[model samples]
Target: MAAASQRKPATLQFFLSAFVVLWLIAAAFPFIWTLWGSFKVELDFFSISDWTNAITGERTQTTHGSPFTDAGYYGAWIQEEFWRNVLNTTLVCIFVVATSLTIGTLGGYALSRSGYKYVFWLLIIALIFRAMPPITLVSGYLPVFFDWNVWGFLPTAIIVLVAINQPFTLWMLHSFFEGIPKELDESAKVDGCTQFQAFRQVIIPVMWPGVVTTGLFSFLLAYNDFAVTSMVLAEQNRTMVPAIAAFLGTTYTEGNVMFAVAAVVSATAPLFILVMFFQRQIVSGLTAGAVKG
Candidate 1:
């Protein structure tokens, strides 16, 4: 009986492990396929005659004299000057993340510690603004931008992105602040630390994980933003997402689809690396409120 029971559990465990493996493969297959195809010519990657050409790279080998080629990357990065868009994106994300975190940390800490009734109302107002679609917000800003002649600039997009992303950061950091015990503040005070000093020294050190989590989220918002960047920035000031869209071509313009494919891979690779590097902090930040500290 004991032997039979052990065999049943072993079989179940094997099946569960297999299921998980299959699920991971299924989830990862599209990205893996895209990554592979990024190195091949469009003919092989999007072959209608033989789907196997994608895997075999037959057409790619014929064209490039090798199974893999850097033509797509070169075309996108060098020929199309996608690097400029990437630089623009980097600037937007940096400014957005820095500005959002600075304001969010201070505002969140204040709201979390304040014993006033208006704090609730303030958060509610922020939530309302956050819930609105970004496009709608952009439309309202457009006329003003045109009047001010600030319509198509990196700073304009950064300002809008900061506005759009601020509420979520405030809410997230506020929750993180709430999770921290009040005793820390009191202890700091006992040690002759002023409120600002306590916040800068004692609270912020403990709040580091939550801050990182919020900053990463803010970075993603600014990084991936298309609607606002597309509308607010001029052709030369376009960011990566809008530039990738341009590579897709519209009715009036011819696009290099392969260039877009390569750009997609380039843009996505960094996100995976960032998440992996900060995985621990993300987890801690998310779970900070679950058990009071």
Candidate 2:
């Protein structure tokens, strides 16, 4: 009886595992297919025999076509549109990440250590900003930039993105700073370090995980942002997503493999780079060495 019961549960577990695996594959296919299809040229792409369509269930044949052109993998990262978007993305992310990380960390540390009456008021203000009034907020900045002839383009769009992300980063970093024990700072003080030295020598190193987390969020905010970027931004300075939107000028190929390829690679690149660089801190930092701390 015991053996039969155990076998029944094992059977259930096996089926459940198989279902989960298949579910994951289904969910991931669009993303994987987009990346693969991005490299394919036009002809090889729509052919029912193309492997590009084969795995994606768009077509049911395994008939091999030219490996890359059919697979939509070659021209993706090489194209002018893709590179343009990449440059725009790089500029925006640099501003967002740099400002958010620096300000968030400093503000977080201050909030953590201080009981100043003004700090209480600032925290409230930060919370309101994080609510993200995209339309209203953009409206506020539009006239100012427009008056200065800075609206709808390069430098101004970048600044608007930084403003959009600032509050969330500050909030995330503040919580991280609060989680750190104050005792460490006190111990550093007893050892003759000043506040700045203690933060530099002791707190900052320990809070690296949190810093990375905050930075990742900041990076993603700028990277994935579309609505505000689209609205606040004008014709010429479109980022990768909007830049791709430009190609949607009533062309059939716009819906074909090349466009998908560009979309996937361009959009995912910064996110991939950030995750690659901060893989350790992001994984470890959410909890931030809490066990040992």
Candidate 3:
């Protein structure tokens, strides 16, 4: 009986280990392939004649005199002026995250602290807005922006992204603020601190985990956004996402698809680094609101 029971446990462990190994390979394979292919020539990478040439960099050696080349990165970044798009993406993300957090922190704090009945309805309305596709909202913004003569600029896109992001931000921060004790606010008041002071000095410090988590999400949305950024901003103001799309348009016909691949790998690098650095904060923030004071 003991031997049979031990065998059953080992069988389960073997299946679980196999499942994990398979899952990891499935998730990692595409990026790994792309990274490997990025160093090879387009012909080799997409070889119809011989796919093994991609792994071996057979043609890359013929052209660049090496098994690998940085030609794609150089072409995309230096020749194609993709660094400008990177700058735009960085600026847009910074502005969107900062503005969204500022407004969301204040508004969420107010909603969480107030006992007003309308606050419930207000949150429901915000939820509805959050649920609506951002692309739908873009058409409405276009006419207004055209009339205001604010279309096709960085600030306009930043403002639009900030507005689109707000409802979710408010929802997240509201829940996070709710997890904080009301007694802290009361104590601040007892010490003659204003409501803003209580929030700025007291709640903000304790709410760092939730805020960091929310900000990461905001940064991601702004960074990864394509539809809104593309439509709102002009050619000169294009962000990384739109620029990659543009690369697809011109590079493929010019036999430079490897440039687009390299751009993708480059774009992915920041997000990878971000996750590696802030993964701990992200986990903490995600769980912070789960517990109540």
* Residue pair clashes in candidate 1: none
lDDT of 2 by residue, 97-166 (tens): 8876877787789788887898878877977887866777877777787798877776676667777777
lDDT by residue (211-274, candidate 3, tens digit) is 8889998999999998899889989999999999999999869988988999999999999899
Candidate 1 structure quality by residue, lDDT tens digits, 1-293: 46864656678889989999999999888899999999999888889999999998999999999999999899999999999999999999999999999999999999999879999899889889889999998899999999999999999999889989988898889888988998898799899999998898889889887888899889989998989998999999999999988778741155457788899999999888987898886676566546532
Flag the better candidate by lDDT, 2 or 3: 3
Candidate whose TM-score is highest: 3
Counting clashing residue pairs in each candidate, in order, gives 0, 7, 0
* Candidate of highest lDDT: 3
Consecutive 10-residue window with the lowest summed lDDT within model 2? 57-66
Better of 1 and 3 by lDDT: 3
Task: State the displacement of the C-alpha of residue 38, model 2, in Å, after optimal TM-score superposition.
Answer: 2.2
Q: Which is better, 1 or 2, measured by TM-score?
A: 1
Tell me the lDDT of model 1 at 287: 67
Q: Root-mean-square deviation of each candidate, in angstroms?
A: 3.5, 5.4, 3.2
